[model samples]
Target: MASTLVSIAGYHVTEEIYNSSRTLVYRGYRETDHKPVVIKLLKNPYPSFSELLSFRNQYTIAKNLNLPLIIQTYSLEPYQNGYALVMEDFGGI
Candidate 1:
């Protein structure tokens, strides 16, 4: 796995909470409000175009969700050599 990312799109990555073949989830805080957030970073040199598309599709769906069971995505931003999906922090449940 790669070293923990320091920050992405202005959110400070405090700790890596999860990792898998496709993604890395981090505990972060929004720069402006200092609110906790979740950052999902795509692995560098994305394994495949389909994987990248899948991430974007998930973001689009999450962004429009209003259910309490679903975490809403705030935005997508380029990070490092890939992308990061900014989401509401659930404090790792």
Candidate 2:
């Protein structure tokens, strides 16, 4: 489910959260009885080839981890001229 109500950093997020990355990260929330979750929004206003490659690497790494301790990558979608990853809603480490 895509949202435009809130934004973290520059990427569109579900709620306002402080994240220390160039990409925006948010604690996803919904009014329609939904579970807590973390949503990562890819912030690439003008992505270069290397940046795209790095994102691909991140995708690969997330796919390979496939274990506990690390949040699971549930889905990836194209959004805001970039991509977003919906992951398991494990709270901050």
Candidate 3:
């Protein structure tokens, strides 16, 4: 299996609590500020190419629909099993 490296400069993945469906919680730091962010990771088990595409598309649609209530995506990267989405840091905001 190929591994995907997610590079977040000022953040670290939290080992405490995580939800399999909705979020990848992380502890982030910038200057003197310590923050938490929930990154939405694209998930699929034994997914074919088409399945992966479906997940991607559905995620896009869901993200578009929930734009106002939630934070916007800051970046996206390919992961080992799926894709990693970097969302807006909303710790202080």
Candidate 4:
């Protein structure tokens, strides 16, 4: 995602929390409810099929775990040319 991005759909991006060669993590809140969320996005504008699969797999696995220690998986939102993995923000930096 571009550094200038301020929001995504119903999310108001507050600040970018993490960045790596493969992903961009942002701290944001839902505009509708004001609940905190972490938005994980693919770094590549057009990710490969494998990368997409990994994102889906991770979300599926985490969502099914049903463990208290695991952060909640809110959604897999479509964005630009890829997707965003939205999760419960545990206030970690």
Instruction: Give one digit per residue, the lDDT tens place, for model 3 in 1-93.
Output: 553433454546543234466334443433235545545554453557775677577557656765577676554556667665556666542
Alpha-carbon RMSD to native, per candidate: 2.5, 5.8, 6.5, 2.3
Candidate 4 per-residue C-alpha lDDT over 1-93 given as tens digits, one digit per residue, 9 for 90 to 100: 556654589999988889899999999898899999999999999999999999999889988887899899999999888889999999988
The lDDT of model 1 is 0.80
Which sequence of candidate numbers ranks them by TM-score, best first?
A: 4, 1, 2, 3
Candidate 2 C-alpha lDDT tens digits along 1-93: 764444423233457354544676767743344656566655657767776667767877897896767777755656566666666666673
TM-score, each model?
0.84, 0.66, 0.47, 0.92
Better of 1 and 4 by lDDT: 4
Candidate 2 stretches greater than 4 Å from native: 1-13, 29-33
TM-score of 3: 0.47
Please say which candidate is ahead in TM-score: 2 or 3: 2
Off by over 4 Å in 4: 1-3
How well is each residue in 30-72 modelled by candidate 1, as lDDT tens digits? 9999989988877656446777788889889888899989987
- Which lDDT values do the candidates have, in the order given? 0.80, 0.61, 0.53, 0.90
Best by lDDT: 4
